[model samples]
Target chain A: EAEVAQSPRYKITEKSQAVAFWCDPISGHATLYWYRQILGQGPELLVQFQDESVVDDSQLPKDRFSAERLKGVDSTLKIQPAELGDSAMYLCASSSRGTGYGEQFFGPGTRLTVL
Target chain B: AQSVAQPEDQVNVAEGNPLTVKCTYSVSGNPYLFWYVQYPNRGLQFLLKYITGDNLVKGSYGFEAEFNKSQTSFHLKKPSALVSDSALYFCAVRDKGGAGGGNKLTFGTGTQLKVEL
Candidate 1:
């Protein structure tokens, strides 16, 4: 079974530092999603991309966070001047298009910790 | 807004016993519900989904969920539990309304299931 890929399974950074995480969705999957999972909570959507175009980013904290998928195959999420509250498990997921009921495949996720 | 709720924060069960995790949802139009499991340091693993199908949906790891439309609930259940089944579980929903509504999923807080020997 094809799976979504993520890099830097774990990262530790001090406050005010910059950090970035990468993800590669399954081949042929057109919708990609970025989510943040806090301890003891479910994953929260940060951004959604549909073939290189952003579909939704209502929950994203734009002042410090940025995300991009230039070619639509892979994506990167960055935080400039990371804050302590930014510490969480960053997960990436992908699914086929035209079907909202399709199952989503999730990446292992990059756990970020800010000191 | 679409939302999911896992009423129980934690559920404890002995090995070989049946387990159930409660989930309720609110959506504007038809509801697309999903259940996922998360182990320590791992990502969310898809367990099952309910979308215009039989009320009872079976999924991986000997798990199943019953979608109750009248009650607006989709509860995850396993006939028999194992130690390996212990993990954090989440419920999510996608509401069909406008473009934004069906494009993204809203998740619940999550429920921790512990299967003890």
Candidate 2:
């Protein structure tokens, strides 16, 4: 089974520094999602993409956070001047097509810690 | 708006016993429900899903979920439990009438299931 791939499984950085996480979805998957999972809480959707076009980014803090799936195959999420509260697991998931009605494959996630 | 509720923060069950993790949802239009499990330092794993079905949906790893339209509930269940089953479980609902093309998934806080051996 093809699984979603993520990089920098663990990261620790200073509060004023920048951090980025990468994700490569399973082949042929057109829908991708970025989520943030805080400690003791469920994951929250930060941004969603459909074939490199952003479908939703209502919850994304655009001033400090940005995500891009240039080719719609791989994506990168970046946070500038990371805050302590941003310390959490950043997960990437992908579905074969639309998100309304199918199972999603999730990557192992990149755990970020800002001190 | 679509929402999922997991009332219990934790559920303890002995190995070999049947186990259940409760989930209730509220949605407009139609309901699409899902259950996922996560171990420490990992991403969420798909366990099961409830779309338009026969009210009973079977999924991976000997797990099943029953959809009760009247109660607006879809609870995860297993015939027998194992210590390895211990993990953080999440229930999610997709917003069928949501903005931005309508595919947003809203999740519950999560429930920790501890299957003791």
Candidate 3:
């Protein structure tokens, strides 16, 4: 089965350090998403991309977080000067279509820990 | 904004017994509901979704969900449970209105299901 790919399954860094995660969506998928999952809470959307353009990033913390999908196939999320509260599981998901009705497929995710 | 709720924090069921996980949603217009499962240290996996047709929707791994419009609920159920079925389940919702031309999903806190031997 075709699946979304994520790199750096686990990451540990001190607070104030910079970290980045990468994701490659399933082939032909046009919509990609970045989400953060706390220990006991469901995932929350950080950003959404349609093709090479950003569709929504209302919930993303602009001051410290940034995400990009230059070619629309692969994406990267970065957090500079990471904070302890930023520790969580970062998930990447993709859907075949950009419509709200399509079901999304997820990647294994990258676990981030800030000391 | 669309939102989802998982009333129960945890549910325990014995193996071979039927199991259910409750979910409710709120949306301005119609809703697109989805159920997802997550194992330890993993990402969310899509289980099923309810769009517009039938009230009962069957999904992967012998799981199913019923959409009740009046009650605004979409609960996940399985006829029989297995030890491997123990995991964290989440319910998510998206408004059909397409407010920002984005397919944003709002997820519930999540429910932990334990299928004991």
Candidate 4:
């Protein structure tokens, strides 16, 4: 089974530093999502991309966070001046189009910690 | 707004015992419900989902869920539990009538399931 790929399984950064995470969705998947999971809470959507265009980013903190899927196959999420509260698991998921309400396949997330 | 609720913070079940992880949801229109499991230091894994037909939906790892529209709940269950089954479970929901073919999922605070040997 093809799986979404993520890099930097763990990251530690000082507050005010910049950090970035990468994700490569399963081949042929058109929809990609980025989520943040707090210690005791379920994941929350940060951004969604359809092909190379952003579909939704209502919950993303645009002031500090930015995400891009330039070629529509791989994506990168970057945070400038990371904060302590930004520490969490950053997850990436993907699903193919044409599948009505397709179930998303998730990648092993990148754990970010800000000190 | 779409939302999900996981009532229990934790559930304990012995190995070989039937286990259940409860979930309830609220949505504006019809709901697309899903169940996911997470192990330590990993991402959420899809378990199953309820779209339209059949109230009962079976998923990976011999797990199943029943969608009760009247109750607005989709609970995950397994006939027998194993020690490896212990993990965090989450329930999520998306409104079927949401705009732009909404794929946004509102997830509930996860429930910790501990299946001891």
Instruction: Compose the digit string of candidate 3's lDDT tens values, residues B9-100.
Output: 99999999999999999898778899999999888899999989999999999999999999999999999999999999999997455433
Model 2 pairs whose backbones collide: none
Candidate 2 whole-model C-alpha lDDT, 0 to 1 = 0.91
- Provide all candidates' interface root-mean-square deviations: 1.8, 1.5, 1.6, 1.4
Worst 10 residues of 3 chain B by lDDT: B94-103
Best by DockQ: 2
What TM-score fits each model? 0.96, 0.97, 0.97, 0.97
The true-versus-predicted C-alpha distance at residue B10 of model 2, in Å, is 0.6
* Number of clashes found in candidate 2: 0
Q: Please report how far candidate 3 places residue A86 from its true position, in Å.
A: 0.3
DockQ per candidate, 2 decimals:
0.68, 0.73, 0.72, 0.71
User: Each candidate's lDDT (Cα)?
Assistant: 0.91, 0.91, 0.92, 0.92
- B55, model 4: CA deviation in Å? 0.9
Residue range A9-84, candidate 1, lDDT tens digits? 9999999999999999999989999999999888888998988998888789999999999998999999998999
TM-score of chain A of each: 0.97, 0.96, 0.97, 0.98
Candidate 3 Cα lDDT to native = 0.92
Candidate 4: which docking quality band?
medium
Displacement of the residue B55 alpha carbon in candidate 3, Å: 0.6
Arrange candidates, best DockQ first.
Answer: 2, 3, 4, 1
Off by over 4 Å in 1: B98-101
How do the residues B2-79 of candidate 1 rate in per-residue lDDT, one tens digit apiece?
A: 889999999999999999999999888789899999999888899988888699999999999999999999999999
lDDT of 4 by residue, B1-117 (tens): 778999999999999999999999988888899999999998889999999899999999999999999998999999999999999999998756553367778899999999998
| lDDT, model 1, position A12 | 99
